[model samples]
Target chain A: MQFLSIFHEINGDLKVVEKELEKYVLTQEPELTLAAGHLLKAGGKRIRPAFALLAGKFYRYDFEKILPLAVALEIIHMASLVHDDVVDASMTRRGHPTVKAKWGNRVSLHAGDYLSAVALKLISQYQDKRVLKVLSRVTVEMCRGEIQQISASFDAEQNLRDYLYRIKRKTALLISASCELGAVVTEAPEKIVRALTRYGYHVGMAFQITDDILDMISDEKVLGKPIGGDLRQGIITLPVIYALKHSQEKEHLRELVTKQVKSEEEVQEIIRLIKDSGAIKYSFDMANIYLNKAKKELNRLPDVKTKKTFKKLTSFIGERSF
Target chain B: MQFLSIFHEINGDLKVVEKELEKYVLTQEPELTLAAGHLLKAGGKRIRPAFALLAGKFYRYDFEKILPLAVALEIIHMASLVHDDVVDASMTRRGHPTVKAKWGNRVSLHAGDYLSAVALKLISQYQDKRVLKVLSRVTVEMCRGEIQQISASFDAEQNLRDYLYRIKRKTALLISASCELGAVVTEAPEKIVRALTRYGYHVGMAFQITDDILDMISDEKVLGKPIGGDLRQGIITLPVIYALKHSQEKEHLRELVTKQVKSEEEVQEIIRLIKDSGAIKYSFDMANIYLNKAKKELNRLPDVKTKKTFKKLTSFIGERSF
Candidate 1:
């Protein structure tokens, strides 16, 4: 809700994006339309699109020009979530049943593929080769990050470097591109584009770190899923990697995690151990580090209302609770 | 082996595409590299890239300009096959274990996704907006076709119209785009682009119909897959659709097919019934109809060596045994 206030000036543009997104999700087939519409209906913060809009605001803003890029970015994010649910075997996302949960993995796979292709189709209208190239590169990196995450699942030996690199590709690059593409499409100066891209990269890192922290400490009621959901799926996030390196109960935690956590009781016990291990504070501290770096990048841009809003967004990411 | 002779003139360009494809499949992660490499090394006919090359040859051929598009087309085709195996629960392709069979479905899904992204990234190097637009549209249609195929699977009520529509999206569109993109990249005359696209479309339809016939009739060793594979997987193709419409044993065949074919004997019995119903000949006749249409399109182009090669390729599709 706080993120909504950041969009007060651009609320009209956001509405147009929402309408365009709804229109894009409508497919000829009833089942596909339903599957794609499911996620579009279960909304999020629309952070990526908002970021794209804000970046455009730094220049002469035109909603029509920015609309397609913003919609495409959000669709790409949504497609990744669909596929992520399949890969994670997640039953729920954002307090709602995932595509995989309602229609089996096969349908989910094709749905995800469809959404991704739709994103490309929408952006193709822009005719900016740079935007297409950046988007294509980001897509490849995001998939590589996912593939790496899967291969590294439950490996307690993974270091901070690996964790940082994974999150950078999985979460940061797309967000970075969102900012860069917005500025590039709006014909902003190269320096401004670079600054905005750096800001997005840092903010994205903090955002994902907070998400990882929430998976460990947030309640099922608040988070829409069980705590340690990632652990149950064998996904070792930043906190878990930190806990593995520094926890006093490293041996017991390793034993519980190296093997699958089958029981709910076992999952809760592991959650408790991770919380007691000081990993949460370490993750928050790490997130703040990135947030501060994001603010520094924002300072490089000229003083404007949009600049303040961008700074507010970084802080918002740092403090977001579910 | 017969297809190799068809590539005799463009052999050097095809080699470049092969190398480009190999380069694109290489990744930093050992497991991903291996999974993707496995499929790339398994070897396809490279028919999509060959089509692109031959189309370009009709105009002023520039191997450099055509190489990226050709490689991208083949990668797209390869990506679909990887995902298709997972969707079909197939164990082998061309007598080689599939990515899903070698690695689990999760890994195969990511690998397929990665390859698709790579294809997009490869084409991004070419600064042609039309190329990007056409490729994106084709990718969306291809995914839609796959989704429709899944939803229609095991449904006995689907008609020939549905079957033709699905294959046009699944097989024909990308192949059609390959030809169109080839001509477009070369800045060929608009009339030539239209002719090549028509030729590709007709050729693609015939190619898939031939594939369907092979699934029902070819030897496992020769086809590199079990006979009646489409039926076993509950995929009703043109031949099956024809038999369902006209066979004297329609009632019994419908009963056996509507239920799962749980036994090898049942599969064999259904195969025999469909064969005796003359569906194979009807399917071949249908394929020839499209083949003739394709040759008609080629005739619109000027008399050139490449035009003759294109005609020969269509004939090869009509007569290819494996």
Candidate 2:
């Protein structure tokens, strides 16, 4: 599998990128700085920055330009994660206590606001108005996606199209913007920018779909949280939708999710039922479809070291059990 | 009083501006929309928009250009208020339940994000790069201000200079930007823009200092919140700082504040001590210094209708108690 192969190369860039992220996400307040460091130390896939750097390689391959954008994307991602932890009331992230859990919700929220402002300020140094414009708009879209999710939780009437749109905003826009913005700031041609954008969009879609599948089927050690947490929160992912279509137990599961559970056993039963219904496999198959499409989009770009890594990412998403 | 004389004109503009705020702030989510409506309906002086409009009148008084900038300023103000409420864990604002109080912290935080995004998007439509740059920087500065306040809270050793810097960010940047941006978009003369910016800066400093005094001395009916709320939260305002400089009674009050009171009566006693110590008058005197400075800045501009209103605003701050 290209997954391990590509991961090795992506790791080579990690130290350099990680240094830039630490430098930029910092604050003047020592407490906040430490809080931010604690959060950043929590391991992430660094997916946005990887894509940003790969896309930049297609143009001038300048780390000077790419590093800031990379750092900015990661900062933006980190900021959103901070707020998301608050919204979800999540205690542990990546097997460690989340910022909100450790410090408190107020500090977590302020830290997120701090990171976001710092991201905008860092990008403003680019003097590239387009980067600011895109970053600002993507930020707004991500927030709108959160609002949509909050408003539409557990509505069985919600369809796949709505789910797709939500993920597009919540997950894909920043990734796509990262790729496109990387190209734009490097003064890449319009066609190259479009190709990179399409590649990011499909890859982002596949990435999120795999995430949904993992939430349903992966081990807690791998996922770093309880399986079916999304379901417990009344977030109906693709697997649940698929399971509902086939199971005679659908009505009971729906009822459990729609109302607050009185006991842990009830939640366990719902998770067990969803797994037995083959919904996890169905969602994985759907994700594979997007992965194939994402790979196809990458074929239009020239063969390069980064493109090889981008190719490997498609397979990584498809094969990722965690 | 000029406030009485200008009341009708200001009220007319505020009514229109408040309606615009409602149109934008109201998410389709019924609960959130209701909470926003309550905050909007609980009315205050719409100073940001007024400054924008008055500044725009210096060159071209077209509401078409000015109104958007005005609304953008107000949106930024409202967004900051939402975030501020989250930071403070505030339960009441403007004599009503805050968004956080009614809808929870997550909803309020997301609502603030939405409002900020809306403001930036609206400002992007102006097609003036300089205006966009200035507005974006101000938004970042405003965030910096919030970070400063969050850092300063409960830090008994915070200096007056740091406090001044914090308030300039927390409160003054938006008001100053409102005036400067309004002028820039209208293509006003350089001198006019500079005058409006300085005027707005001084006026904003005065406004925040007055707010600090009112938090100690104003009644709940007038303040729209419990008196001594800042003290309860361990925020050392100008009045508290001034009082801390004098009197053994001030030491006792400071001790009470540091001890964390459990009863409203304890809070009341502290408030009485601050009032009896002449701290409120001392803060008012400091505010007058800023007001006089604001008036001096306005003198640089030739006598015009807008400049006259600007002068009136300086006086209005000195006499807002009426």
Candidate 3:
């Protein structure tokens, strides 16, 4: 099935979020407007906002009441990505020039700053301090995750635990907050909110795992950037960590991947070596475990059509190859 | 009277804010805690937080209720300064190595990001949404101000209006919010809130103008950084702008200040030329206008002791040479 199928029911609502996102990012400064709006135009899957919108539907769902939060979740995601690019000194994202690429580091830094403040503005409109609290805590963790990743980069001795902790904060925490805050905004009951939060957390972990795997094997065209990009940058994702610990060519993998600079050929060779090992299967099984845990969380929810959609989303994540 | 006397009444209260600031910055990541706490250890005036605390005293002021906000205000100031150092590539602040200098730009960037999130967390303690709203809006404007300064840097053509707008957002807005949020969190009457906010705004403007003037003539040892640092960076301030337009050697001044780099001799010469041009007096006049306007706003408030402090603050800002 197409990945679009999971969000098909809410595509119209997502479109509203997309439109409002443009307006929310507009500012008095033209250059700022351009830089802050740059990533939104480039576009992502809108998965976090979709997760939020879907989670909000589990209770007294009002689209207008929930729209600001949905938009804010996506903006938070975009804000982090903008700063991430600055940290990485990345020149491109989504096959287009990144904000950091067009503007200098200073503009990109303030653009990210402006976006984060904008997100706060949107979340503040909800009047529930819980939403702001959850986001603030999660955003802090997200920043810590980014700092950890920077510190952990190119370290051959980093363990599986290190990789998990990093990804948990870097990706899973915000995704989990999306679901939790969505339920909170909709006034979902305690049980429902907890279930959805755990579900989102598990799905987020699996999603990031799948992304790590795809970074090795996905067509560069499909991924919209180079394959092994993470490896080239010494991020040492799940598969690489697994290969470093368990693969037949562990020594060579460690030496090559831990190198400060990797040639294109070196990156390709490392990718090939990891693929030939069982790391891909090992990583897939791990992701499936998370998918199963995510499905178990839906079992706690009331038998609504949304639950069925949740099942399909998990299944899609399980079988997703790209 | 000394600058310390302005906050003498709140010395103990400011101490609480200082202690809480240390605890607020602690994270699971020790390096992050260190980087975020570095500036806190290197003391500042605690002026923004003191403004909030003092402003909280006008009506129904509860010390415990406002303490979180006071600490949060200082954290916000530190966060901006940390990010500002990155934007300026400044290696030192407050006569010490900056976060950007001790750690890399990436660490400093994430450190700033983490501090901002912590500020949001602190503000979330209030059930009232207005505090968040005011903060979010002010923070966004602050970012826009920073970006404007970057874009305006080194451009010889910027006018007084450009400098005014930039400083309004860059300095005045947050200081205004500091006083405004204190009034808000204390549930002060709307009339009083408006008075304190305007008071903060005008005082902030004068405060920045005074800093700009001092940047040209203050002792390097007293100012804690090199004199003429702003002029050297191509940031045209009010006094420099005045000199650029009115000095006998306007062309020479412009040529020297606008150069991408300057030797110590050129910096000294540029400072001497601007000081001799009557630009210092012109800039001082602008600052006094703001201070006088700030004092007038206090007349609308109740005859509380805090109002008297506000008056003295304006006076101190007017005449403080250091």
Candidate 4:
């Protein structure tokens, strides 16, 4: 059950999205094409598009109408990753060189802006105001979340609520928007749209928590980057937050986490301590809560097949490694 | 007359836009507020908004309905400047510290992104799809123009077509969109909207040419920046393009222009060579052509007062020193 294969039924629609992305990003500047194309080539799960397609199934499911929105959602996701790499100056993502690593931060910054502009343009073709409103609000919140991440970095007093708001804006809202947008564009009933949106929010939260947990405990090879990458960047995720409050080595962990510099050995030590503090289990428990809530929303939908697929998707998110 | 006072009749409306900017950019992060506020304090002409307001006057003027659009256009302009400052690594603008100077490039980068997202969200409230289409198209062209500028920087082979298209995409299209969006929103006929768009396009071209000219010849205290700023950043502008073609010292100028690094003396010498070549006069001549064309577009409009104001605005664009 690979993530890409999970959307096997909608693979034809996903291919259209892939083609549209290439057509839009292809420009006169060869270097720009290369930089902008780097992330597009590094295939992701297409989770946002998949969610949109699935959510559309409960209603009319006009693939042609949904195509632009699907592509726009994916581009927005890609744009955020490019900007995130610029801020962290991360050279590699998912085992591929980032735009920043290849073309420098200046080009990476503009490429991200270009992709966002392209996404906005694509969405502009839609006749509905709700689609634009949903996407733009999500974009604004994501920016606030990014700024908050920068300011809150290395703050020893970082709390659960701060982390929750940041991750929700950064991840959940966009995912939620994808489902809401797909449903809206297909003329879904209001009740069904709200249910799908709630499903997306809970699933997105569960997905991000799983990602943070894996960053601490997963192998570097499996994670596609270094271990404790978030810790190295002073990103204070859930495990670190929980461990800070309850770990036996709480004082030592804080000292290591708050340090301006960390060697490979220090990162290894920090990861080890976080793993032993029961924070991993605690994070999973919280994720299970979200996953269950996500499935509960699927119960409100009409189609048995789509509902089953969503439940399976929720389970996969709760346990995904990469 | 000062640029601000040029729009004396619209001062109260501009006040609302200024207040709205403060409201939208004021986030939870104090650092973000400061970075986003830096350029607002620097206070360039609200040229784009003025163009929009005047364009709207040709038919029906609904200030309440048009307010969001006016603010969005201004925000788009400001966003581009913040991004431009980041790319140029500029320390000051209009005699005030840039966002990049006060808060690092990372913060400045996100602040630009925040502003763009806010602008897009503001436009989302519009019932008309044409507004989004025009603005988003302008945004994409600007990004392409920026990428082209990067690719063409410091190249000895740069030509007039490259220079014209770059300036048009970077400066003219947004201004054109400002006018077009205003007209479209206010229920203007297509022909009048096209005329206003042409007016904006020509005025914007003249405005950027004059700005480039001022960058070379104006006092640092008045220009609010050092001379040869564009050359130092490898941004080949209109005068440099003109001088590269016809200057007696063409070979020497090309040699200096294409160099990886330049001294202050070299910059001053390059400026002198360009000035001696009459390229400044040549650029102003071209600007005058655009100014005349811009005024011609106004003959199609109805209101005598607004048309006179637009003509006066065109002249101001052609001759402004700062």
Q: What CA root-mean-square deviation does each model show from the true structure?
A: 3.1, 3.8, 3.2, 3.0
Give the CAPRI class of candidate 1. medium
Model 3, position B20, has a per-residue lDDT of 91
Task: Decide which is better by lDDT, 2 or 4.
Answer: 4
Q: Give each model a TM-score.
A: 0.95, 0.89, 0.94, 0.95
Q: Can you rank all candidates by lDDT, best first? A: 3, 4, 1, 2
Off by over 4 Å in 2: A1-14, A87-103, A126-128, A154-157, A259-267, A302-305, B1-19, B29-32, B60-62, B87-103, B126-129, B154-157
Better of 2 and 3 by DockQ: 3
- Candidate 1 regions off by >4 Å? A87-103, B87-103
Ranking by DockQ: 3, 4, 1, 2
Task: lDDT for model 3, please.
Answer: 0.84
**Each candidate's lDDT (Cα)?**
0.83, 0.74, 0.84, 0.83
What's the distance in Å from true for residue A243, model 2?
1.2
| lDDT for residue A319 in candidate 3, whole number 0-100 | 75
Candidate 4, residues A59-159: lDDT per residue as tens digits?
88899989999999998998888766563222133334433442255676788888899899889988878899899899989988888887787777989
C-alpha RMSD over true interface residues, each candidate: 4.0, 4.2, 3.8, 3.9
List pairs with backbone clashes in candidate 2: none
Which has the greatest DockQ? 3
